[model samples]
Target: MQKSLKDLKVYSSSDFPSYLPKLNALYDDLFSGGKGFRSKLIQMVSRHLSLKNEAVYLLAQTIEFIHNASLLHDDLVDRSSLRRNKTTAWLKYTPEYAVLAGDYLLARVMVNLSEFGNIRLIQYTAEMISDLLEGEWIQDSLVGEWNVTLEQLNQVHNLKTASLFKWCLRAPFVAQETYDEDIHQLLDEMGGLLGLLFQRSDDLLDFNVRNYEGKAILGDLKSGYMNSFAAFLLQDCEEALRLKFKKAQSLDEVKLLVTPDLFERRLQEFDQVNQESIDLYLHLMEQLAQALPEKEQGLRDDLIKLPHPLYWRKR
Candidate 1:
């Protein structure tokens, strides 16, 4: 049976002891009110595999802690003041404290995994975190380079986002000692595609299309990062427009480079591409469903729901 989000939260909350009141309070604030979407994803996959719920809870908490740790560090790196409509940890607490807090969570993850004592799982998770850091470094280096290709953007997201998704899907099997090469490969592909869809949808949110919350509009533009949508659409634009875009340092300057007609045309193209990607996501979901064992056919609907727009929506 699938665990409810509330149940997931209970597991997450009980994972740590309140030895330090300040740190505990900081974590409480940070973890409170989150949708626990990643944990939910793991639970869904666990349901499909009929894996042990207790083990799933631990893995879910591990992933969520790592994820929140990344966010705490990310908010500091980006100098973001707000996260999910609340003041970021770095700002509410101290930057130094925030850094340590993030590190503490990661250390806790290692300790938890060490207790679990699955060498393969630990090795894979360590590799995933390494890949995620590399993605962050690559994306940071690419900032202010407006000519970023769709391929380059995709590669970064594959490491940063898809890696976690892939782990969520395959780690349960790893826990079960199932090591099925075919299923692992299939999950990898599914995660890559789903990551692209999620990242692109997020990129779209930065470009004036209302979607997920958190980030401000044109945040990427101001930060000198050419988003996936912009990178793709810019490919079809003339060299002159591209040059003008390259010279832009702010969202206002970017707006000046694009006429209303051009903007509308690009948005239309983006919408078309987004719909195609959605179709592909659905197709992949269907493929996964067919490939799953007959006993797990009931999971098809739940699996499909994982990537549904409703799940992705913030408001």
Candidate 2:
């Protein structure tokens, strides 16, 4: 039977060693606020396969652990004051504690996977983690670089963000020992599209466009990071205006500098480009449906509903 998300407990105090109270406390705070989107994605994909429930839970838990670990480290690196409306881990706890907690989660991921005894799954997950670090390194280098291109940001997003999505798509099949190369390749492409659309939509939130979530406006600008939307908005701008754009502290300032007309035009163009990716994803879903066995065809229906919400931010 397919399980509802409520049935899955991806994290609990019992999962960690009780000897270190601080570590547990740090994690309790860290994991409590996340949307758990990636883990849910794993469950969605796994339901189509014939895998055991234990295997599905393992994959879900693994992704959450890796993702939350990245967040722990990311909060420290970004020096952000808040996450999910609560104080960031680095500030709430010591920086050293935050770092140790992040490292511990990653270590636990490997330990859990090793015990699962799937050599291929273990190796692939390790590679994904490596890609995530490489992405972070490249992203850190791009900070304050106002001239960074969308292509460059795409490279980082693919490694850091898309890698997780790709793993979510492929890992369930891998767990079931379905090693069909074609199926994996299509899933890879679809996952990449999903990640790009998601990241771009998130970047839009920085500009407060369709920002239903009320995320802090201009956080990326203030942080010296040029998000994908910023890169797109600045691509055609002159040097002086680009400099002005970087200095924007408020949304009104950003709008004034970019001029409301140009900003709207660029936003439309950005949405159109992302819409092309959405169309491509749907096409890939058609191909995926054909590659999947008849019994798993229902998975395509579930996945097709993702791109619209992911890119459009419609809840």
Candidate 3:
């Protein structure tokens, strides 16, 4: 399965416009750098449901394209100069080209999904695009708004991050003509929960937690941008923790807030809250798995085992 997937990737890369070498390079660069988390999740889920051969490729392609498109736009929004230890698309390519390339990938995702002739899948994808943009706008609006609530943050994450995840599960079932409303609802809840956890974990990467590599430590703090995690932590946290967060206006201020002991305490607190949420979501995932096609229980099992090493996955 992995080999076949890799081959498809090669095909995707090779399909680039011949006259646009720079655009092709940009596509290849971003594609190779990603963690492939969503792709992996979709595969595991599809296998659990015993989805047949031809369908999987379309699902995989749809997801990878959607993910890459979002990243291109995100980097542009963040003005991020780097991603995956390399210059971002907007940084490496001109902003115009980066946006164009992202748009191109999105178009390809649609054309690819059309192979299924699944109108529901196509419609969902269209809605997802709008949701992605809506999420970004909401998040951007909350940038300097220190009072951002967990409810508000999750709502934004649902639109931006979770919607695609919800699509991953639903699209396959929709394709199979076996759409179970109950299971679909459960999966949507699971995806939404997972997105919140995933994004919160991503936010920690920016805090320099566990001496982590990659994400620029204190980057969000420095940017006057409080992330979902920070927003959660700040909500009714101890006075000192709240005060420490409030003091941070930029990266330097964030750097100063993370003394060694505070870092340790911060992580412990995060794990406590994070684990509770993950466990709740995992339960929802298991409930959703009950609706899986009979032959794919193993895939359902994998869903439960997911997000492995639960507590330390973030650290």
TM-score of 2: 0.97
Residue pairs with clashing backbones, model 1 = none
The C-alpha TM-scores of every prediction are 0.87, 0.97, 0.86
Residue-by-residue lDDT tens digits, candidate 3, 1-315: 433644445226566778888887888788886767777667767765556756877787788888888889988988988888899989777899889988998888888777778888788788988898899888878776777777888889899888887777677777676667897788778777677677777787776554354556767766667787677556565666655776665545654555546556666787777788778877776776576656756756676765444334733
lDDT string, candidate 1, 236-298, tens digits: 677788777766665556656786566678877876776676677678777777777788677
Per-residue lDDT of model 2, residues 1-315, tens digit only: 754456687988999999999889888888887899998999899888998888999999999999999988998899988999999988988999999999999999999999989999999899999999999889999888989899999999999899999999999999998989999999999999999999999999999999997888899999999999999998968889878888888998998898899899999999999999999999999999999999999899899999999999875
**Predictions in order: lDDT:** 0.77, 0.92, 0.73
**Candidate 1, residue 295: how far the Cα is off, in Å:** 2.0
Q: Over 4 Å off in model 1, which ranges?
A: 1-6, 10-14, 212-215, 236-256, 310-315
Instruction: Indicate whether candidate 1 or candidate 2 has the larger TM-score.
Output: 2
The ten-residue window of minimal lDDT in model 2 covers: 1-10
Write down the RMSD of all candidates, one decimal each. 3.2, 1.7, 3.4
Q: How close to the true structure is residue 246 of candidate 3, measured as C-alpha lDDT?
A: 61
Looking at model 2, the pairs that clash are: none
Residue 156: error of model 1 in Å? 0.7
Quote the positional error of residue 297 for candidate 3 in Å: 1.9
* Candidate 3 clash pair list: 48-299, 222-250, 222-251
User: After superposition, which runs of candidate 3 have C-alpha atoms over 4 Å from their true positions?
Assistant: 1-3, 6-11, 236-267, 308-311
